[model samples]
Target: MTTTHGAHGICLSLLSSLSLSLMAALCSHPALAAETDSAPATRTLIQAGKLFDAHTGKLRSNQTIVIEGEQIVSVGAHQDGKPGDTVIDLSNATVLPGLIDAHTHLTGEPKFGYEELGISTPRAALTGAKNARITLLAGFTSVRDVGAPAYADVALRDAIDAGDVPGPHMIASGAALGITGGHCDNNLQPYEAHAQADGIADGVEGVQKKVREVIKYGASVIKFCATGGVLSKGDDPEASQYTFDEMKALVADAHRLGRKVAAHAHGGDGIILASEAGVDSIEHGSYIDAKGIATLKKNGTYMVPTIYLNTWLLDNADKIGLPEFYLKKEKAVAAVSFKNMSNAIKAGVKIAFGTDAAVYPHGLNARQFAMYVQMGMTPAQAIQSATVNAADLLGWADQTGALDAGKWADIIAVSGDPLADITLLENVQFVMKAGAVYKNNVAK
Candidate 1:
């Protein structure tokens, strides 16, 4: 059975790669192209003056990338081209792979509370549809939405895959699980309100059941609240929500189902406990300590330090209309989160790109790159967090991590060299996903 499955996987990947190559050849036939001169043309070749590869941390100059549909068949000079073949001259701009954000909440808007309560599941899907389009245009070709209400993220992911919506390739966790009155649960009202979240499960049996239910509902990943959160009501950010046994069940079940687990843990004990449970990644880690850092490193667990959300909140909290409790929680957690993240980075734990995008606006996900650079990461290291490392975490390393041959043509360009000034990522001038140009602001 294992051998059969392995063969199946290989065949699937080969088919995906071959389809792009076939499309590129079919789309660029000079004779067929001239015959259909009245029709629109797809890009066949891209000339890049400078390329920043996240894998090598070096900038190469004067390179050619040949795209066959959505995949790059070759990355070296290939002057032989049929007539009417489309060429994109990005010699004036620095090109690289499209950005990936491993952490996002497309369905949930910026504010959460009474306003969030009012939004039904269908409304959440609608919001995801809008946010997904904006995120894609911002040069994030792929994103993993870790949490959403009412399984709305499932609907959104399907819609995007079906071409019913314009968005990044998405891996969606249908709903984030937690205990009663914990971060992922409905804490705004009493149980009498009948507003309990589907994720509010307890004990090993309870969490196991919930994990299976979420997977049954089409969740590509499993997200469980290991610790309390700042945005949620009636929970201290420093407390653990799931016990070790419960977390173990969640992880085991999720892995058995072929899904990775992302633990939303802030407190030190919770991070440590979640690591012990074999959770694939730790989110927030606001109060992570030396012990927690060691545990993460020992387990090879990835840390998704969402440092920018707190900073963005601190800057715009007053305008966002956060409740008083949330304001206090934000202030308390922001500094601790930053300090812990700095410590974790120094500890040398594996890290990935994950901006809690719904906490701020969706399109501004690239802002996290700047914060990563601020936290002791070199410019290339920062870029890798959103490309190579992020893609590895998302299991898309084969398809979309770098601008290499046989990978998806998810490319972006910036006017300035990000190595010289990391802040240039904030302004993505060009975006091409799956061989389709979504935004091109280059000057003629």
Candidate 2:
């Protein structure tokens, strides 16, 4: 009787092993594995109380936006979502297209004088990760990172794209092209150090080669310092750094490669030169004169006037630890920036919003909108500068700029009507990028 019982237990164990083997084989089949691994499609419905028509710079009431995956499927009048759809109720808020910043240096924040000497390339990349989140949460869902050391912005962009970190959609440039001892160069060190900047290139041939190199190394846009800057040591902001021939070569090479060029031009001469050379956008047009404005209009060049930093810098200069040289330059630029920018805006030279964020702070990007309104721009025009004009400059108008059906689902909301009070955008209540909600105080 005992022998019979042992044999029966062995038989039962063998049967169980055979069943498990069969199940494993079936599960390993390609079709079955795909079925098991695939997740259900996500459908999100956003009920907007008042949707800003970014395309037309108007407002439409009682709208709904449907998102599938990372793109907008449809956006129209209110409709009930089907079953299994995630619904976000922003019926009490005003929804608009996500804001864009045409100029940014995400790899570094506010730093002063000699303190910038110690921060290395790796550290800058880490700083970029932090600032990217802050910028995105502040409702800037797309940014063009104009410069960073060692191409760190490219790595940061890649990490964000791979889902390893959260950041706004980024268009990163390589090291900004400049002449030796220019603003883009490391001009602080003495003759012994031979501290050549990553972007230091002289002559037309040198700059054209530099442009190709940066593009080869993953630069989507080419940024070149066309004039001296306030922050760099031993340079005059009113002086042009790149000659017209070199600027022409740089612009030609960048355009040939299908990348836009941004020229950091503060002086009137530099602005006119850059505009005449066919640069896509002019940054920091603090000294723009009548001729420069005419050149910009003639070339259809966009002006990314980073005008808000003037107020923030003057208000917080002590905390920022600017040296006497930088402080003096800042004061000089600040004194004239508003008048020049206001004149340009009044003259109808296209303006796009940018706030040299690291020079002030990252999250305060929206402050520039108020400054734009102060500069004689209507609220709608100012908003369009950040949205439509910026997208056009970045060459991403089809993918962003407006809440259209085929665009990425980049959306934001404010508690009040921004047309009535543009400052309301400073405190964004809801933020969504690529169908993902980063901040939604309305739901909370």
Candidate 3:
């Protein structure tokens, strides 16, 4: 679990070069050969039919993006080209900044039912790698992996970053912090059986210790179960798990360490407590009331309503192989997710894009876009939640979310305009992350 950070150094460097070559081959057109030769030595021009400017929410027409190495040198009307550049002609497709998922567990674990009968850290890591590739191909170039057992997500994040695996740029939380018997604790069998999860901490002092421990072990963000969750057994989803004092302690400790806190809260009391505690974002505010929403709004807390998980869970419950108690819990929560999220959105609460991805399947993260639109957000606004809003919440507004000069060259292309039909986002035809192309639909 505690491996060296630079283990895959050689592999990642080679993968980076391969990523560039793949894009060059895919975007090169015979007719554009002269333009390519005249371009900069390491520039790639992307001809976009329609581009979603996440910064302005305005779709520009007939745009060409200039990329040099892992940064966007310029994006707009064509500047003159230098020699030996690559040109990708997506003149038939609509282009948008790569999508971001704020809450995702890249490492696989049964969301409901089984609890943790036969799972292992290595198995979870492999599953995470697979899911990461699927998610990247789906157009999510960046994701914040919230939690996994034994810091598995940290390994996955490094793997993807090192090019040992193809996946989204990740901000890994390492593990979620929970009080003993709280939602994130591995409360599989009775307490007499075994205390397995490192996440379980108790009281203000304990939570503060846990926060420091996780950060020391390489957690980029900190997560806590402020309330009971739908998948955990024996806890009422409406019950607040941690006291306000405990939450305040956790948030203050994480923030003082320069880390943001994501609170997993369902009940109204917990949501309000987390908001008031200065957590950066609240996850799954299923039982939020008007007062809770107001508190979140007034405090500038972002809500990551994972609306799609309920539908996916109900539709594929049998495949999940959960224990009977967990299954019942999923059934109970599934019935109310839509209404809960819709009301939250209608209330004008600040929303960031998050999908409880492991609860459903991983690659299908983009499916949440249409659900967001159905929940009263315009397509443009929904797209922004996954882009600009998510970036801002992650404190990466300067680097990743939008397509602009001096930002990472993370971009994706689709066959149609997502602004007109948000469903088009579900099928990302081309994917490029940090100037490397992992998927190209236009390639022969």
Candidate 4:
């Protein structure tokens, strides 16, 4: 009877094993089976001699990046290259995270003397497409277009995202909100002229209405003119346009709708007011003083000092058809911008790299890096301002601005280390965005 029991137990064990196998097979039905059988294959492997780690501001040597579809699957020393994977050997170059431009006007160029002859929406959109391609080739894989005439920038951003056109990833603010006769307003007209720019909102109610309108038009960010601007006619650059209350209202409304506010502020009062009102970043803090610097630091507000614009404008003023009045303003503001930015850096204010690119030329955006370095920022810190810090300001930290596992494969390579000579970044030899290589000097 004991022998019979032992045999019966063995039979039960075998039956149990068989049942388990059947259950496993059922769980691995065709759909599940296909998933297991068809793991995603690596599409590309970037073999880099040196890779810039934007997170730590360090250079990692002899790295390989494995990519799958649009994202980086893995990045390390022993990254396995799969069969049929296209390999880009950048062993002779220094690979880094693709550059980011914090300020760009993709849709419009600065009008020189002919204020009425500004490019139409359709024409501006076409120019934007061209500029986008040039910018991508120059190695800026992402940009935060701070302002555009009307809502042209919004359409361009959508077009690039939808794959209808080739361009960098864009975080666009459709149109800058402003009070009547303020910097963002089309105040170039004579007193008798009736035309006004769309963003000319007055008082708290007017500004609030304009902010909502821009948000409805698909602005990922809200831009407002907190002070008079050099480019705008008949406004004092040092005078604050929007009152503190007005700015606070705008910031509150934008933040409530899950959007960050970018204030175009050039004066001390405007910068301080915007900072105190909790704006995300201040653009062109050209006239920022000690109090403004303290306010920015205390509030943790970022300063996007477009230092290059002043110099570029002064140099190319005539060629770009700058009006006599605007030229005078540029000359007056240029020196102040450099000094104010230098002081802001010394005062420990948060800096985000931004070049008012449309004010100069699109492809020369990287020249701003040198200016940042000159302003007491280290080369590494300057690059970081453009990459990690700018990404944080744009709310795109999780997606781009770093070379890491699971980030979008937006990267570029130069012949030499940018850390050694930051100017090398001004001429990128290779460009890749979303796992697709758009420029490669070696392959060419």
**How well is each residue in 1-444 modelled by candidate 4, as lDDT tens digits?**
334358878998789899999979977798877777777665889999988889888899999998888999888994656678888899889998888888899776666556645568788889899999989999999999988777889999999999999999999898888888888877766778786777778888888888899999999999999999888788888999998889988999999999999999998999999999999999999899899998999999999999988877877777878888788888888878898889999888888878888887788999888889998988889889988998899999999889988899998999987888999988999999998889999442
Which 10 residues in a row give candidate 4 its minimum summed lDDT? 110-119
| Ranking of candidates on lDDT, top first | 2, 1, 4, 3
lDDT-best of 2 and 4? 2
TM-score of every candidate relative to the true structure: 0.89, 0.91, 0.88, 0.90
Candidate 4 global CA lDDT score: 0.87
Q: Model 1 — TM-score against the truth? A: 0.89
Q: Model 1, which residues run further than 4 Å from truth? A: 1-43, 78-80
Residue-level lDDT of model 3, residues 44-79, one tens digit each, is 988888889997888989888999889998889644
**Candidate 3 deviant stretches above 4 angstroms:** 1-41, 109-111
lDDT of 2 by residue, 250-366 (tens): 999999989999999999999999999999999999999999999999999999999988898889988777788899999999999899999999999988877889987889999
Best by lDDT: 2
Better structure of 2 and 3 per lDDT: 2
TM-score of 3: 0.88
Write down the lDDT that model 2 would get. 0.92
